[model samples]
Target chain A: MMRRREARLGWLFISPAFFHLVVFALFPMGYALYLSFFKWHLIKDVRQYVGSSNYAFCLTDETFLHSLWNSAKYSLLSVPFGMALGLAVAILVNQKLRGISIFRTIYYIPAISSGVAIAMLWIYVYLPETGLLNSMALGLLGEHGRLTPMVASMLGKPDWHLASIDFLNSTQWAMIALAFMSGWGGLGPKMVLFLAGLLGIPQSLYEAAELDGAGRWRSFVSVTLPMLAPTTFFVLVTSTIGALQVFTPVYMMTKGGPDESTNVVGYQIYQEAWVTFHTGLAAAESFVLLALIAVVSLAQFRMMKSTLVGYATT
Target chain B: MRRKTWDKVRGALWATGLYALLIALAAFLLAPFVWMVLISVHPWNTPIPAISDLIPRGPDGQVHLDWSNYGLVLFDPNLPVARFLFNSAFVTLTVVVGQTLVSSLAAYGFAKLHFRGRELVFALFLGSMMFAGPVTQIPVYLLLRSLGWLDSYWALVVPGLSSAFSVFLLRQFFMQIPAELDEAARIDGAGDFRIYARVVMPLSKAALATAAAFTFFGVWTDFFNPLIYTNSVEMRTLEVGLSIYKNSYGGSNWPAQMTAAVIVMLPLLVVFLFVQRYFVKGIMLGSIK
Candidate 1:
């Protein structure tokens, strides 16, 4: 009787969350999958049974394919750079210095601010000529600054000009600019995660390395990197997933413009569903995105396992 | 004595270098915000000021800041900035409170109550976290539309009422509270509901605050959901409203745009300043688990 009462109470208490799961999560998953098999017009309320055609079209769609590629490019640009910068700041701020929390709080400002606001602000930051970045560069590095010539030579384009480089308006630099902005805005959370990982590292390991005459650099290379493997893996997977779904920045700043160079998968999906009213096609695209995330995450897990083994062997 | 003096000099130099790097990085991170605040105060209907001219000045070379842009953005006749702010604040608060309550109750059941398939149910919740916004957005929108919840508060509040992450975080915290406390309450003629309310809820304030802080920020800054769910200007939240404002009225009016952005950003910054401890603690807890 007591067991029966407890079980009943348990079900009662969990009922709300269960309701959410059934209505929002489970139902949506099955419905989206079902919707993927139909060519449904959201506005016209028209439906046709089109088995696997939506998926086939998505796979062959040039713009959709390009959007996926753009997501991969963004992940490539942002994730590693963001992680490195985050890890560096995390190490710097992990000290027990005076007023350290102040720095931590300031750094974290970008992470909490509204994405649209940040994107709007960055629009000015990347504006040509009178904008913050260009103006600052011009002020510090004169009109005929060697930066233009230097970058031109490095890229093997003698006429390539860094001056008046309208970052968001230029096809070549738009995605890169977005990547840098995301890196800046996302640095705080990654730093906090890495700091937590750093705090978890046992001090005795460092001491042991030091006792064996390992210098600061050596100890960092051996003890610190090895110990931070799990955290690094976690940050990597999460950051990659986040980079793939990046929409607000593209929507606010670029709208997948400057020759559709910045058309990320998220924006593509949005355009398909809402803008073009291709609801079924959008559902299929989202499933493809889900598949991409699963494959990427699984690949990361395998790569991390191999790296751990390599570290152990070394 | 000379060796000791040299070591002291080196240590002083190291400390100075560390501080200099930290200060420089902080300045870089904060530069955009500083610029936004400065530009928001520039006079209305003026050309986009140079970085140096952002701070207003008179003919006499005295500092004279103009807050007219802020007033214009806030009290514009055509724009419903006030309405958007109300929608954002109300929706965010409702979601925070509702999410916390439902998640905590479920967390209590998962943590303390004995039942068959408890672990299975909790595992399902954990697994569901992986299939967030992108996958479910279309179907959920269809569901909300069918319910005639479009352009309504029901659309915003209901979808955000329960989150898997909140449930997970609260469960982790609730499990740490002593079961002996519950047993003691039970022996004293209190039931599970009373024990949960009187015992677990008070003990879990910090955890609850952390979850609420996350919810508040997420709901407040959310752009996509409000954009799709609400089509009319009257129902639009601050994020979507601000974006429309920028595109519609912000052609060359940089100051007005900046002012609007600042208005949207200010409340979150102020709240963050006070409850930042919970933010840091919550993040650490999330990662540690």
Candidate 2:
């Protein structure tokens, strides 16, 4: 009787969250999948079923292709660089140094700074004149600043014949910027994870390596790298997802702009849904993105031999 | 003995190298905030020097340091950033409370209780977190629109509450709680909710704190949803409020916007440091840690 009462109470306790998920999350997802099979604008809508046509359009659309490529670019830049930077920092802070936690804390701050603010700050830093980058160029280069010519381009004068590297002007650099920023912002979580992995590494492996005449780099390779595979694998998968889903900064900062140069699939879906009012196309795009993420993650799992958490035998 | 000496030297070198690497990382991480503060304190939207150095040089000829911008953000009633703060705090606090209670209860059910289809339900919950947040915007908004909740707190607070990730984290931590506690609580004739409220909750405070802090920070710092959903100037959150400064001052209008950014970040900074002690308990939902 007591067990029965507890079970009843448990369901009662859990019902609110279940209700929320079912109402807001599960229902919307089902609706979205249903909506993807047809067309409906959320604003003033009629529903029309088009079967596989939405998927077909997404598959063939050059714009979709561009968005996917941009997303891939961002992910590529973010993952390897982000992981490398994270590993380097974690290795640094893992040592027995006083006040190192301050560095750890400071480095971790960016992870909380969010996308819009970081992009805003970067915009200031990259400002062509009187901004950090140009100002430095002016000071260092003296009178004939290398970036002075590009100033003309902004003025629409002589096309600022030189020193023109518009980071957001083209698709490639836009992706690079997104990737780099994502990496920069994401460095914190990965570093912390790597730090934990570093701590988990048994001291015996280090001692064995030291006795075998291995130096710092050699130990890092032979012991640290091998042991850290799990952490690296985890970081890579998450970062890959994060990079692929890049939206906030691109929307806030660039709006996929200077000519849709930086539009990643995530941003494209947002635009298609919200801006263009093409819910069906957006839903189809979302499914495609989900499929891509799933495939990539599964492939990674297969490739990396990542360990399951509680599985002692793995 | 000679090898020991070499090891000592190696250790010192490694220490030096570590410090060097850390210094560079610190500079990169701290540079933006430092620059933001500098720009905030100054008056001109002019160029800061090219070096990533934190010092503000008053754009060649200007001499007087302009702190008027900072004051304007605080005192200007027209800007109404203070109202934005109140709105943000209210919504954030509500969501934190609601999410904590709901997610923790759900977590308790999934973690401690024996329920049918628990594993399947748990999987569904986890999968929702991966469902692109933006994907549901239209459909969800349409529901809110029908309910006429576009500008209301429910749209902000309800949709923002109790995510799969939070549930997963709390459940993971709760499962790790010794089963003896629950069994003992049951033996003492405590009801499930009573056991949860008394024993489970107090024990799970670390996990609760982690979830609370993350949720608070997320709601407080979130820009997109608020920007899109809330139309009224009065309904705006701090993140959206700051964007007003962005539009007015123009992105190029430095010093002023950075001041606004600083103001936006100040509360978060304080709350972050205060809550940070509880925040670091996150070991990820998986046990790879």
Candidate 3:
């Protein structure tokens, strides 16, 4: 009776959540799976069995490969750079400096202020004729090109057959531009998480390291790096998951534009569903996406598991 | 070697690290915004202009700010942003109320009620978080369609009433309350609904507030679902309106396009500043665990 009573109470505490989850989330997944094996049209009453054709078609699709590559490039570029910047900011603000909170707030402004209005804003900044980057590039070119003329003069390369090579169109530059956007948008949240982790670290370790005749850089490497590993792991796992699932900027700014150079898996699923109205194909694509996300996340989790568990229980 | 020299060297390096990181991030974050603000004030529709001058100049050759973009978006017959705003508010408000109340009640049942397979059910809820709408949209649409709710307010309202995060958050909060309180109320001959309403509801304000904020943000920021389901401009949300105008402005109207983006963002900005205290407390309490 005692065991039964305890089990009843536990059951009581978990059922409502289970029910809501089942109806809204779990059921949807099952239903989505069932739908993926068939074809459905919006305005027409047509239902045809396609079996695994949709899945097979994705293997041969050029758009799918492009989207997959773009997503891969974004993850490779943004995750590492975002972490570097985040760690640098976190260490800076960890000091007992005056007016540090002001800097913290200023850095946080971009995350909360994400808007569709950025299209016009970024366009001006990247405009070839009068864009801030180009004008700056032109000035730098006169002074001796850092990276400007090589990129601008890339169309003159005898290697590829292209007349005009715009950044959004050039296969080399398109993903990089998107990666920059992700890195910029991601800085604030990652910085805040690192700040929280830094505060949680004991100050005595640093002082003890200093007393042991460790130089500043050496102490940071020996004490701080290992101590902050857990936080870094957490932030990286979450950000990479988010980076892989990126959809908004591509939709708002690129629309898989300049010959689908910025197309990603998320946008591909969107295009399949919205632009082409292939709900079933989209479902299959989404399942593929879900599997991909799960696999990547699991690999990251396993890799980070040893490093992220805090040392000294600190 | 002087201690003073070492101290000065360390401080300079730290400052260098601080300034470089902050400035780079701020430029990245702020550049688009700065560009957006400038474009909103610019006198063209193009993101790029062919003119020799990048900066705005009035006919009198003096630099002057233009306010016509706001007037055009607000007053133009070709666009009805007011309708979109109304649609957005209605959808958000409805979702907030429905998600909060239903999710709360369901959370109470999970946190308090007893039956079979409860743990399995709870496990299922956690598993569900991994699934995004790409899987569910068609099924849900079919469900809504069968009920003849396509392109209607019910289509948007009914499906979102059970936010998984809200239910989970509320369940956690509800679990923290002592079980003896419920036992005492039961001894007083209180019905289950009375026990929930007169007792549990009064104590769960923080969790409910968290649910409200989450629901509000989800609904307000949402565009994809509404865009798919909604057929008419009247029923379309502000984000959709902002998207349509981004392409349809039909001229070098970068400034006006920037104005549109700013206007779409203004409400969330205002709400963020207004309830920032509550939002921070609520979301952190709800999620970080």
Which of the numbered candidates is closest to the native, going by highest lDDT? 1
Interface RMSD of each: 1.2, 2.1, 4.0
Tell me the tens digit of each residue's lDDT in model 3 across A1-314: 75577466555444454455566677778988887888866457476899988888776778886777778778989899889988887777767766676676666555565345454455555555356566555554533445545655675743332122245556677677777766666666677777777776798988999899999899978888887776776777677777877777778767777777778898998888778788888888888777777788788878777665645466
- Model 1 RMSD to the real structure? 2.5
Task: Provide the lowest-lDDT 10-residue window in model 2 chain A.
Answer: A305-314
lDDT of 1 at A268: 98
Q: Ranking by lDDT, best first?
A: 1, 2, 3
Interface root-mean-square deviation, candidate 1: 1.2
Put down candidate 1 lDDT per residue, B135-181, tens digits, no spaces. Answer: 89989999999999999999989999999989998988898898899
Model 1 residue pairs with clashes:
none
Q: Write the per-residue lDDT of candidate 1 for residues A1-314, one digit (tens) a residue.
A: 99999999999999998999889998998899999999998999899989999999999999999999999999999999999999999999997778899999999999999988898799989888878898888655535654767766788977765457799999899999999998999998899989989998999999999999999999999999989999999899889988999999999999998899999999999999999999999999999999998899899999999999999898
The better candidate by DockQ, 2 or 3, is 2
Query: Which one wins by lDDT: 1 or 2?
Result: 1
Report how far residue A12 has shifted in candidate 1, in Å: 1.9
- Candidate with maximal DockQ: 1
